[model samples]
Target: MDRVPILKIGDILLVSIQIDMEDQVALQLQEDLAERIVATGCHGVVIDISALDIVDSFVGRTLATIASISRVLDAETVVVGMRPAVAITLVELGLSLPGIRTALNVELGMELLARARDEGVNEDGDAEDEPGTPAVPAP
Candidate 1:
């Protein structure tokens, strides 16, 4: 029943969870988020799960899968708004997400994303225009 909504802010796609947290929903999360990530071609993904009371293996796996596919889709996925207890439980459960990024909060996560995008641009030294930074570029 709980479905997350994906919002966009400055090349970052922010997804906030609705708390259903069912296995079926978990699978949908991977597919839907992956599609959005590929469609937007954004630099970062912020997933808010503060409302989630529990994160079992299914949800954890779904998140990891989303992160993995997001990378292939050219976007970085960082799970934000995870409570301390939830994080601790996830760690204890032996679900180690290798490539996925985690942030304690949304603001911090966005900062991390900004830094990543900047680093990528600077590395190339192309001085190309940045993506999703307030002004909507012409298509």
Candidate 2:
């Protein structure tokens, strides 16, 4: 079984899927990602799928599940590097992946994560305050 490696960069977890993922692999990835987020105290997750040429319903749901799980852990999830064909196929297949944040590439994904973290908001729109950080007063 091939396991997806999750890299911790500062406060972000980066996952680059470079192969065609089977259902079991995707499930394993979901589990591994959640564990990594909790273990590393990461504030964001960026999944790069640029190399994946196809995404079926199972894969799509797995991605969504990962995103949702990350959010519940107070970590933002940004799925980047979605190919144009994959996007169209997902839409056509009725897999819109609601509540999952996306970016064109890793650079933009990192920026989004940084902005969200700086604003004290998680991917699920919940407000979070970093310890020892001064809270901003509401205008």
Candidate 3:
């Protein structure tokens, strides 16, 4: 089985999927990513799927699961490089891919992740403020 390479860029992990996603490969990726997030303590995850022309329901679900896992680990996930046909196929397959944010390309995806990190919010919507720090400023 071919394992997807997960590279670390500053505080973010970049996953560029260049191979066909089989069931085992997808599951392995999920496991590997979770471990990497914990090991690296990265605050963001950018998954570039531009090379993939098709995304099946299982792959969609796997992506969602990966995002959820990343959120739980205090990292944000952004999927990038989705073709129009793939989007339509996902919709037709009835997979909305909840909890997955997308960007047009790797650069945009990294920007989105960086913005989310700057906002101090994880993918789970939790604020990453210091202890006793107010979420909003006083009048």
Looking at model 1, the pairs that clash are: 10-132
Clashes of 1: 1
Model 3 misplaced stretches (Cα beyond 4 Å): 121-139
Cα TM-score per model: 0.78, 0.83, 0.83
lDDT of 3 by residue, 1-139 (tens): 6999999999989999988888899899999999999999998999998888999987888899899999999999999999899999989989878779999998888888888777764533553454565677787
How far off is residue 23 in model 1, in Å?
A: 3.1
Cα error, candidate 3, residue 39 (Å): 1.1
For candidate 2, report its TM-score: 0.83
Number of the candidate with higher TM-score, 1 or 3: 3
Computed on alpha carbons, the lDDT of every model, listed in order, comes to 0.81, 0.89, 0.89
lDDT of 2 by residue, 31-132 (tens): 999999989899999999999999888778888889999989999999999999999999999988888899999999999999988777453244344455
Better of 1 and 2 by lDDT: 2
